[model samples]
Each structure stands twice: as C-alpha cells, then as structure tokens.
Target: MSSDALAELSAQLPGDALLVGADAVEAYRRDRALDPTAGVPLAVALPRTTAEVQAVVRWAAAHGIPIVPRGAGTGLSGGASAVDGGIVLSTERMRDLRIDRTTRTATVQPGLLNAELKAAAAAEGLWYPPDPASYEICSIGGNIATNAGGLCCVKYGVTVDYVLGLEVVLADGRALRLGGPLIKDVAGLSLTKLFVGSEGTLGVITEITLRLLPAAPAPRIVAAWFASIEAAAAAIAEISTTIRPSLLEYMDRTCIDAVEDLLGRGLDRDAAALVLGGSDDLDPDGRDVAFMIDAFRRHGACEVAETGRAEGEALAAARRAAIPAVERRGRLLLSDVGVPLPRLGDLIAGVDAISRDREVTIAMLAHAGDGNTHPLVVFDPTDAVAAERAELAYGEIMSLAISLGGTISGEHGVGRMKRPWLREQIGDDALEIAERIKLALDPDGILNPGAIFEAR
Candidate 1:
C-alpha cells in the first residue's frame, strides 16, 4: 500500500469518495465485534453507485489490494474487519430506494439501514418481516450478507427469503444482476440466494430487490416466567411443536437482571427464565395464545399473562435490548449458536454447564421458537484470566451446538472469529467445495479477504 498506489486509486473516484490518513480511516477498521487483530486499512472507499463500486473493485484488483466490503459497521461478527494494506469499501453512501406497490418489492441500495427499509416499506402499506435486534443500526446489506434471522423470522423467514434479486460487483469489477422482483423465477441457478449470506467473500452487493408483504396483523403477546430454565425451554419446545409463533423469545435470569439494571424495567430478576410468545394470526379464537399459555402452565410457569399491545411491544423491546444491556456488565464474546427444536433444551442446559465449568457469566437469550440462542459471554477485558475463560466458554458453546446437530452460526455468518469452528461443523468436504466456489468467483481473493474463508 504505497502512497503512490493510493494516489493512483484515488484518481479513479470522486475526491470525497476516497478517505485517507489514519484519522480518516480509523473508524472503518472494524465492525461492532471490535476484533482485536483487525488491521489498519490503506484507505476507505465510500462508493455511492454501482459504477463507483466497480471502479473501486477494479482499482483494488489491479493493485492486488484486498477489499473489505462494509455496511454500516454493525455486524456482531468481525466479517467487516479490515485487512492490512487493504481498502475498506463502504456502501454507506449508496442509499437509494424504490418501492413497486404492484410488484410488492423494494429495490434498494445496500447502504440503507434495516429499520429505514422497514419504515420505507411501511410508508407504502407494505411490511418487511425480518427484524434483527439491531435493525435500527444494522444496514440491510449486512442483514443480507448474514442471512439475518429475527423475531419474525420464525414465522416469515430470514433475510434471504425476502431477497429476490441482487446487483453484485464481482471481484473482476464485472457488475452482474442475479434476479428480479418476480416471485417465481426458476430460469437459472439460485445465485441470488447464494449471495444472500455470502458475507462479501464472493462479491460486493451494490443493490438488492426485496420482496414485501402487506403488514402483518397486530400480534397478541403471552408472557411467561418460570422457576426453572428447563421448564421455560420445555414450554418453548411445546409451543413451537404445536403453533407457529410470530415471535418466541427466551431470556435467562442473568439477562433479565442486566436489562432491569439498564432500563429499570420491573423484570423478575429472581426467575430462572422468561419466555415470550406472540401470534399474529387473525383467528378470533386466539388459538395460538391459548396454546402458549397452556404450554407454559403445563411446564410449570410460576406466572403467565397475556400482555396488551403496548405492553407486548415493550417486552419485545426489552428482549431486543438484551445484547447492549448485557454488554454494560462487561466485554462480550457473543455466540449465535442454534440447535434443532427438539435439542433446544439440551443446548440451553449444555451452555449453562459450560458457564459454570468455565467460571464465566454467560447471559443467555434466544429466538426460542427457532432454537437460535445468543449466549453472551461477559468478562472483564482487562482481566486476562477472565478474558481467557470467556474465550473458552465461547468455543465450548459453539462446540456444544455442533455436537447436538446444530450450526455454529444460525444467522451470523462464519466471520473471522468463528472461521476456525466452521470446518469442524460443516466438515472438510463441504468446506473444500465452498472454497472451490469462492475461488471460482473471487479468484484473487480480494473481496472481503479473510472473512468467511481465510486470506490466501
């Protein structure tokens, strides 16, 4: 990354598009994961259009400079972490969008935030279902990159489900359009879905075509508190087995107490776990609500109640706040491991065991209906002993998920932090095939180097 090389690259874009110097490029070095090993980038390219992104890609390719594609820098995994001598190609400036009411789709640039896209869809009386906790801050591009799952995903599906099309800038600077707004297009390979969770290893997504639906019915919420974590897990399993809950979430005592400390919410800190279930079905009989309440009671819920719409939203918001609330306690090594529905209870118990054995505080929460749990390992970063224990517990949790026929990452992509575990979970054969595909697409390995796959 010579100054002369950077100068040549800078000449290809708008004067303001290329950011240089340590101060200018500092913030683009890492995403929310704060990966300690993140490198200092040669520059940050803020591309505003597909042509500009192509230019950046071409420049990086020509100079043999790695390009780390970043979107809003809100990823929990270090997928957006910068590489040494590489350029951080950020899509923050490409914030254009259009809604096709008749087609029920939104064609949007990758820079738009998830919440912003949701709001834009709502303005047209359409709804975008995937709602990750960080929707307000996480970019839609990042969500697609990770195939993000959220509260509504259990019912409506993840980001990939809504992504009907993508305009991607390949490693060689060739811009390719993969799909369109049409619902049923089976004319070619499912390339659009492939890139949905590629995490920028294959190409840089410049634009996305998102499918939208008419707004869901206002959901009825059921809140249940149990004296035992197993009991809550059992309730979740039973409810999931029987009903398709629009939202099903779990929070353990550690998380509950942390949130209470942060928001002063009257959460039952003494309870072992809290389970929330919601149903948006238009049935007047409220069958889903009844089933959830029954499951909770049958599983020994100490308290169960149906919250009003406002109260329900508040509870859901509290669940969304769990990550930041737990973060307030100490540094976090977040794990998004998930197990099959039947193995959900075992996964939760296994994580509890790991926390105790490792002597670390692991605050657990989940989109329980789908069995995707976020076991947040909290530790004092300055305390070397505690940090080591936290790291051990993090790996153990992912291993536990793998042993129980679960994925190392349910929604978050296998970013650098989880890259080591990916091979073990997916097996060498699958990994090799994936690497072959990566090589086929990104032969030079310049796009988001050292992300899903290691740098060559």
Candidate 2:
C-alpha cells in the first residue's frame, strides 16, 4: 500500500482511530499465537462504531488492501496475524451492549469481552454459556469468528450456538444483517450460521445478536486422578456413554505438572491423568453425579473426590489456568481436535504415543465429553532441533486425529497455522466449494487474506 493511500484511509476514519506508526501498530500484528512471521501492518484501525468500520472497509475495498479483523487478540491460531501492507481492523473500541429480558437476548458490539458479557447477563439473571479458557481476555467478536468452545460446551454449546444474528461489513463496504432475535427463523438460507465461523474470511463482524438462557443451576463437581493414562481415558469414555456431565475435562501428566508448578496447588504430580466432571441439573432423581462417580470407579480411578461448591470452583479454576500455566514452560502450537465419543480413548492414547516418539513435551488437555482436546506442544525457540521436532509432532497429532475419523479443528477455526492441513481433512471437492464461496463474497481477496484460503 502507498503512503498516500494510507493517509487517505486514515483521514476517512474517526480521530485517532487509525494508528500508522511502527510502534503503535506493533501490538496489532499478532494474537496470542505470537506467530514469529507476523507482518507489520500498513496501519491499525480501531473503529468504535459500525459506521467507522464501514469507512475502513470502503477504503480497503477501493485500494484493494487486505484487512484482518481483530478482537481481544487472544486467539491461539494465527487467525489475526497481519498481512504485509494490510490493515488490522480492531473492534476494541466498539463496546456497546443491550440486554432484553423478555427475549432472553443480548445485542452487543464485537469488542465486548466474553467474561464481560457473561457478567452482564448474570446480573440480569441470564447466562451466556460459551466460556473459552481465555474468556476474560478474548473478545466476543473473536469468539464468534472462531466459533470458540469451552468447558461447558459439552452440555451447553459453542459460540455459534448462541449467535442469533450478525451485522457484517462486506468487502465492498455494505453492511448486511444476517439473522435476528427470533429463535427459529428459516426465512432464507442459513447464511447466519455460515458467517459465524468464517474466521473473518468473508467480512468484518461489527455487531452480534446473542441468544441467552435462564442462569444455569450451580454445578456439583467430581475430581478423579488415575493411575494410568488409559484409565483416565477409559473413565472419560465410560462417562460420556453413560451420562451427560455439564463439564467433562481431562489433563494429562504434563498439564498437571505445569499447573502444579505455577500454582503450587498440590496436584498429583505422579498421576497419569486427571479428570474433572460437573453436573448442573437440579435433579430430584440425582443421576448425573452418581453416574460419573460410578464410571470413575469402574475405569480404575486411583482416587475420587466429590466436592461442595467452593471446592468444586477451585478445581474448575485450575482447569481454566492450564493453558496459561503451560505457556510459561515454552512457546506452543495449540491443537483443538475432536474424535467420536467412542474413540476418545484412542485419540488421547495416540497423542501420548506421538509425544513419546517425537521427543516433544506435548501437554494434553480436553473438554472430554465432546471428544475435543487441546494438545499443546511446548518447545524452546532457541533450541532449533527441539522446535523442529515440536512442529513435526504437531502435524503428527492432527494426522492421528484424521486417521481416527476425527476433525483437525473442532472449535478453533483453521486459521493460517492450520490452513495447510485443512484440505487433508476436508478433501478437494469441499475445499473447492469453500474457495468459490470466498471468491463470491470477497472478490478482492481483501478480508483476512491468507486466512482460510490463500490469496489468488
């Protein structure tokens, strides 16, 4: 992009909304992935309203400059990484929200943080269930862009489930409304769902309409430590088949050790794995918790603890802290893969085997009930050999997931990091269709270039 084009674009936007200097644009170049190859953008546009977003989109479309939409910069994949000579369109300033009790819906701008939305909903006796590990730091827009999933997703759902509508700015700068507050609307095509997880490939999401529910009943938790990794995987499989736990999570030896090292929480450092379960139902029948405990015992749990409210929360907090704690160990390549519920054991075991064979410190954790796992590969950037091994191990894990009839990406979108493997999972016909759609919507190839599909 030329300097004159940058100046013209900056002038079109509101005061101070455009940051073009090198130092000011540094933070906008990468998300949590910290992609070493991330490029310095031509500018960083922080738009506070849909109009400002339209202005930026117009400028980009006219100049044919790529625009990457950013939320709270908490994405694990390089979905928000800047393209060379492009602009990073950030939604951090677009923080506006309105909650409707009668409709049980919240109309919010893209910039709101997930935890902020949750707190706002909670104050109105409602709940927004999608809670990623980085819930407090991740933006609602990024969550929607990635179709993020979290612990409660086993019983509740992911970001796409709650998104009823969106206001997206197209490549040509036209603002389009996809859906609305109505719960069931088959007015046209399922365009709303299509946009939910597009990962900013097609357009810029400026506003969102979220569906809500009555606050969930406080959950009772069950914690189990296993003598062997197989035993923990077995417990998870058994429970998934027998009961629908509100939250079913697993952390292997590496994860437990990482968290323990950081928190000094007295986690079983020698245990092969740890499984956490939760039940949110106000059941007079009392089936969920009992079923989980029984499954744990049947699958060879070394020890089990069913706890009160406070103790249960402490355990959940530890699970949420796993990603950040493990990050302290080294740089990471995070994989979010999912297999069939029945094959959960095989998936976990396969990942363990990959770690050993590759000689990489692969810390594994999961939302077990949904068969979704996040295998974090830790490597020292200074050690070239170890980093190469970690990269190989990362691809191997995805290949393993595919062999077992699992997806390469479960909730996290196939951002730039995972783009190469996407065709391996989806095959040529599907990829072709996806590419055609991308061309149709973003003809200029300006929105999040090199994200899902590469620039032609």
Candidate 3:
C-alpha cells in the first residue's frame, strides 16, 4: 500500500506491467456499475502471463494488499471494483488464445473478448454459445467469472456450461489446473464448475478451457407486441413450457421506449410489452414459430409476426443495446433478479407496483425463457429524493424475486453491489459453507476482498 512496497512489487514484475499514476489508474477503478464508493487503488497490474500473475499475487500476499482481478471492466455488477490501497490486477494484456479443432475446444487467456473468441471458433466451424449482451466488450474470463448467460442461453446454456477447465493462481501465488478437454472427467470434485461463477474471491483466473459445439443454424425470430405485460408473461410461460426456444425475451414499455429513443427503430412506443421468440432449427413446418405466434395471439398480443435471420439479428442487437440506451436517460441501478417461470408474471407485477410506490422509472427486461430479469431503475443522481427512491426500488425488486422463490442474481455475479442481499437469498447455511471454502483458498482474504464475500 505504500510507495516503497509498490516499488518493490514493480521490481518483481516485468517492465511496463504496472500503472501507479492517478490518471492512468482512474479508468480501472470502477466497472459499468460505477459504484460511487469505488476506491483509488495503490496500482493497476497488467500481467500478460500466469507467471507474471503469480509474481503479482505473491507480492500482494506479502504486503497483505487486496487484489481485485479484472477482465474488460464491462461488468454491470461491481465485481471488479477496486479497494482503497489495493492492487487492481487487470488481465487486459493477457490476450492469448488457441483453438483445438480435434477436441473442439478453445484454450484462451482471461483477457480475450467474447466476440473475438466466438469469431475464432466460427472460423474453425465451431461456436461458443454463451453470448452475453455485452459480448462485444466483455471478456471470456469475466464470462467464466460470472457464469454469464445470453439471449440464446435458454437453449445453448451459460458460460459455466461451456467452461471445461481453468488455470487459476491461488491466494498464495500457487497455480492450479482443474478439469480438461475430456468430456467425461469425474476424477475428483466438480472444482471447475465451482470457480466458473465464484467471481474472484477464491483466486485469479489466468486462462480458461471452453467446450465448443458445431455451429448452429441461423435462427428465425418471432416478434410479438402485447397490450398488457400480464398477457406477454402468460405467452412467455406457455411458450417456455411447450417448446425449446433458442431465445425468449421480454421488454417492458420503458425499455422499449428507451431503445426506440436511442435507435429510432420503429418500436411500438405505445405497446405495453414486446416479446421476441427465436428458434435455430429449420423445421419444415415452422412449428415453433407458429406456436409462438399462436401463443402471442392467445394471450391477446396486439401484433405478432415472424421474421428471417437478417431481421432477427437486428432485433437482437437492439435488445443487446437496451442497457446502454436506458443509461442515456439517467443513472441506472440495474437489478438481475429472477423467479420461477410460473411466477414471472407476478414478479413483473410486483416490480410495477414497487415502481409506482417508489415513483421511479423502472425499465424491465428479461431472458424470459429462463426466468431471469433485469429491472433497470433510472434516476437523476443530483436529485437526492429520486436517487433514494431508486435505491429502495432496486432492493425491493430483489426481495420480490426472493419472495417468489427465485434468485437475486441469475447471471450477474453477487458483486459488492449485491452482496448485502446475497445472504438473504442463499440462506445462512449455504453462505457459511461458501465462506469456509473462501477461507480455505484465500486465507489472507487478499483476493477481491469485497466482491462475493467480506474480507475475513
């Protein structure tokens, strides 16, 4: 934490691997969450290899400095937020990747962008299916850290489903390799799965081994506009139970309005909800597409239509741009709360009620097929009253999801922003066991001190 200690650490690392100046380190201090309390770090370490990461971790352990492991800093949760007098160990410079066509896997460095990985896989006639909304900017390592899910995850699965192995540096700077390319390796504990969504409390992930699949057919999309959110929810529930969908998404009025404002894409500004259903299978009967259209109509959708892959991709891009579009309106306190499919309607209704009571604009969107939702609460920071209400609405939404027998976070990890409510969701016993595991791996508690767990 001191200049002398930083100097010593710098000497141990390769030249140009550390950044100490205030100006150079400012950008690494916070993630997309922009947690106002994000701290100024002692220095930002950019390690390119596992050995460099080990050196940095050893120095941090020696100094008892907290190390916040970061990827592309595209996290909506404050998982990578820096600690005061801590070291922000960024993997941005570790951009090495290899594709094994024989094994149909990708062994990649932590810093590789998800899009880059997808492109690489595609070149080899393979595909990495976990496509988060921010895939273009987010890192594959961060995806593994949070077990990220995307639009297609309803069928393709999340980041953890594709992660076959990882190379991680422990708190004491020792590297451990878990799992491998073999599809049926049950040799020991399911350790690889454990670290997939651990955020960064246990250790720093330097590299990942991902499972890939033969590229899927381009999907056709079904767009439906509803007169009521309840109707849309009912349609989503029915569609989810009846058939397998590549993607099933919902955007409430506020989200649609925001995106429309940003893109002017002819979205129905007056519609109560918009549901996008998709399928990649080239069914001769177009059964799934017809079923979705029928469900939409059955649930009183005002308009329903099927579109080809070209149009579907455009709509998906708009969906991906929702968060940033909403951000343009005001400060956003994003909530990744989810409930059972049967209770999806109830969750949205409860959120609506909370918004009315809090008097805040809550833009709701979801990967409806999987029951995960992101309720974006927008408010002006300078308006103290509005800001306070937004905070209340955010917590209330999570509580609502928990009450409905759901999770506080479906894909986004329990970063510091969501930590206070994590215990509420997982219960005391599960949390206690998790804490014990953290202690076992990070005894000094120097690895991401305030991420998923408090510093021990």
Worst 10 residues of 3 by lDDT: 1-10
Output candidate 2 Cα RMSD. Answer: 0.9
Q: In candidate 1, how many Å is residue 316 off? A: 0.5
lDDT of 3 by residue, 1-456 (tens): 467878899997888999988998999999999999899998999999999999999998988989999999998889999999899999999999999999999999999999999999999999999999999999988998898999999998889888888999999999999988878888888998889899898989998999999999888899999989999999999999999999999999998999999998889999999999998878889899889899999999999999777778888988999999999999999888989889999999999999999999999999999999999999999999999999999999888999999998899888989998988999999999999999999988998988988766
TM-score of 3: 0.99
Q: What is the C-alpha RMSD of each candidate to the true structure, in Å?
A: 0.8, 0.9, 0.9
Give me the runs in candidate 2 sitting further than 4 Å from their true place: none
TM-scores, each model vs. reference = 0.99, 0.99, 0.99
Pairs clashing in candidate 1? Answer: none
Please identify model 1 stretches exceeding 4 Å from their true place: none
User: Roughly what TM-score does model 2 have, to 2 decimal places?
Assistant: 0.99
Candidate models: Cα lDDT each: 0.92, 0.91, 0.92
* Residue range 169-194, candidate 1, lDDT tens digits: 99999999998988999997898888
Steric overlap count per candidate? 0, 0, 0
